[model samples]
Target: MNIFNSPQRKRLFQSMKMGWYNFAPIEEGTGIPLTDQETPYALYYCHQVLPQTIQEIQQASELVGSVLTQVWQIIRTLDEDTLLYYGFPEATIKLVKYDFLAPFCMRLDWCWNQEKGIKKVVETNPQTPSFWFECTDGNNKVARHFGLQEPDLNVQKTLKITLNQHVNRAALNLGKPVTDCRVAFTALNNAEDLGTMRWLRNYLESKSTILPLEYLGIKDGKYLFDQRTKKPIDILFMWYPVEWLIHDTDEKGERLWPALEQLIFENKIVIVNFGSAFALQPKSIFALITDLGYDFFSNKDAGTVWEYFPKTSLSATAIGNSYFAKPILGREGEGGFAVNSGKISVRSSNNDPWYTQQNYVYQELLEFPKLEIDGKSMTQVWGAWLYNNGHDKFISGGVGIRLSEGEITDNLSYWCPIGC
Candidate 1:
């Protein structure tokens, strides 16, 4: 805590504040936000990490390279209306009020490390929540909440460098030789990732054209290059709600948005970040890993993932229960079915009946390795290794971590420095 008095901390805050002032919202004469049609940005991001843990995270880069080759192969061939799974509960939060315009993408929040090896996707963010922002806010909140300075994840360069790795991979994914694609980052579209898209665009500006979505006007069903060309923009990118594009009401009057139906049938835009990648059967991946002799645990049936290998110990069937249900594509502790006091309480959020996964693999909850931070409670820095397709069999760059103060990580939990 004494580190706050140090000059290093002062410089960091000063830099963040400067970026914040430069990128805050704009006001128009009408007293409404003059939404920057092309770019909407916020600079409330700071980088921090645990050096030793970050080193391991860096090693996880190899997994990104390994997985994306397989991931891209899967996406390139799949139809637009394909379905994927969300391993984390927060991902469900993003789909809480899904729309066609902001329909989900192939957002994955898997942990990669030397110990767990490749494709160790325990959970995912709700469309890749920006940990850098969470790290920034976490630092501010702790300081205010407790009236005491806490170690900030931003204290370590791991924060910026790790995010730099993720975006760099995304840029590489959409870079030249891959159809000369351009990026169009949308706020609240891909949720936290919209902030990340700008960071990625800055990195990509040197390699290729990084155009904000506004530059390529989206009209009717297609992204028109211009009124004159009107052929349709080739590259399609968004982090917005799917509902904005289309929505239909069911007999129960509950609004439902089928983004997959629209994206596949409506246009020819190249959509990366394929949602859920639910089509990739966990059973197959598990078999591959097991065939290779890896010792990780995974449930094959989506019906009973909650009975075993559930997201958190809290979600596990109370001690002796033999039956539990879970969404096939559940993530971040959402859509759980726990057997409580001889009662099966299945939790689900916005999972469309059409795409609801029914498979389940039940297994005992895993004892996720823990990291103990000095002056901080037990923290598990969940690693996210971002991979670009077609570079090599190795993950593109460094990794990101979701630090938590509790047993199960949720809501972009705050993380802090371990060494200092």
Candidate 2:
């Protein structure tokens, strides 16, 4: 039975096409397109999990968030040389040191082997985590279509409150009311990135604007401005990755990143997912935490690290076989590979030199629960979101599931909604 060609699958696709799921079109710049016969992006299916599994995932996400929070605290106190060793670009070191608070939102990628009851977090995306629309509204629509109960029903509400609260706090910190703040949301010109930003911008209760990354510029090396409106932006909520943002240049190839960094450092502009969040984006942070050992962490945090995090090292050879090698600043599983029995088994096709040329971290590989979809086996990776509720408190926002044909969940992974 080919599920993709089934009647239910067709109906599900139609429902998604007519609803808020904007990433369905093959030519919409949402993601990598597939052959005409296959669904290019989201799967017209919902994967149901036990209520206990949902609770466990939420609890584990909060614990991992705490450990990362502690690590970020230590990272902020480190000197330049130490930060450079951990893959922080020297150009943005000063900006990363001037901390604001924990990132407003982050997503931890996890591999959950239900049969073995093992959940291991692989990496953290603190800078620009996507799938916001897919996880909340899209998940609800998919669950309703299948006549199943949506897990985390209040996720949309929670996200609205969290985002608005963060905006209000940023406004207050800037010595202005929320109504007076000009919050600009920018992203590359693409469906997925723009859609995610637009979705998030709608939840913001402050005065807000949306524009493409190209329209954002710096003036007089003091503040970032929207080129279109010719007005200085106060708060920037961008989908651009910090690692890449450091290298941004103007039309004449003059580097503008330094000025942008300076603006944040001088308190001329506020960046959500603050500049310091870059300290948490590197894959090497995992290796750094593991190397720090039990003595560096509180007893409870040490236990959390050992229980939830995969053993990571700066050297692939140190992990021997059965390890995953990932570039320190890799995004969307780019420049990553897996070794099995001392032989390279799975590797990402995206050999983007920007990521491939960077340092790599080797991590112990964990088993991923598999499912048969449309007559092919797919590996599942669960994404748990961590949100900061404006009071230095961390909470699990929600969970989303991505399925891929290979071990690596890349840009083309299917967005399979989760049901309780």
Candidate 3:
């Protein structure tokens, strides 16, 4: 059946025409105008998953979180030479020694083909989980339009609660009242970054302010300040990836090292998705956990880890056959390639200019479930957005589905809404 032909689909399109969902790109030089840019209509139908599936996903997410937490603990024990091999800079290694917020927001990408009978984790973004705007608001609007029911789909409510909880915990660390805490949310001036921040700012306007990330500076070499007002920022929520910032340099060709690091070490600023979370960005960590076996994990966690986690390793020879190779810190499918029978079948053309210096990992390949959408057979990848309360405890925020004709879900993949 063509799901898009229903009355609900037409109503959703009408809502789009009525500007119920609008987007504005942040950059003018990118050629994408500040206008709405002919917004795409969200998926007309909701994709439903069984309750058991949801439970298993949540369990798997928590297991991933646990393994990563242990990885952090293990990193601090490694020598400097070993740390550099794991893609950590001397500065970042120091940050790992301290107890910091991890995975304040994250997403685990999973693929499950019915014939396989198990969901395999494809990748993880433990720092700066994007797509909050679409997953929370757009998903609900689509669900309501289709009269679908999903008890765990209230993402906006969960986001608000989680943000508040994170900020409150930061306040305690700063020894300040939660009401007196000053917060700012920042991202690079790209369309996705800005739009996501704008949507979140709209929801958090009453509690915090939105500002440019460039406004950050150090005062008198002893304190961190918001350059706009030269006032010290108490807490910050960054949409930019922590790894990128670690390698960034100022316009004068000077490295931006230790400006953020010093602030965090001195307790002058509380940054969400804390610096330590960078440990989870690489694919090699999955292989590390896999090699450790189920001895360290709980019964459920052990089973989930073995079932969902893919066979991954830091070396290509470790992957005996068809596999996927990806940069440890790549984003949006960039610097990634699909290898079939030890030959490169597909490679990403969208490599980021800044991420050229990272190491790569080879992972076992898993097939995505085949689904029919818009008169075409497409591969579906489900992303479970997970939030960590800064204490290794994770809560399921919501789910986002991306479909594409190709095997890899890149920046061009379509966002399909989920139903009950």
Please name the candidate that would achieve the greatest TM-score relative to the true structure. 2
Where does model 3 exceed 4 Å of error?
1-45, 48-52, 151-154, 201-206, 298-300, 352-357
Model 2 TM-score is 0.92
Q: What is the Cα-based lDDT of residue 289 in candidate 2?
A: 93
Q: Go through the candidates in order and give each one's C-alpha lDDT.
A: 0.37, 0.80, 0.70
- 1-420: candidate 1 lDDT, tens digit per residue: 343234544455455442221122345434333335323122123334345554544444334334433443443343333323222222222322222221122223443333543324444333343454433343554344334443334323433444334334444443444334443444432223454455444433323333333344435443434333344444444443332323445446644334333433344444434333332323223322222222222222232222212232223343355433444443444344445456655444434443345445332333344554435554354543343323333332334444455545544344332221
> Pick by lDDT: which candidate is best?
2
* Candidate 1 TM-score over all chains jointly: 0.49
True-structure lDDT of candidate 1 = 0.37
Error of 1 at 209 (Å): 9.4
Q: Write the per-residue lDDT of candidate 2 for residues 186-245, one digit (tens) a residue.
A: 887666677678777778777789998889988888678899989988888887887787
**Which lDDT tens digits does candidate 3 get at residues 1-420?**
345345656566456432323234345556454664434434566777566766666666667666566676676677878767766656677776674665577788888665678578888886664656556677767766668765265567777877777778888888988788788777765556655676676655236766677777767657766788776668887777766677788777777766767777888788776665676766667767766678977786787678778888888888777888887777878778888987888777667755545688888877678888667898788777777665667777776777766777776566777666
- Output the better candidate (2/3) by TM-score: 2
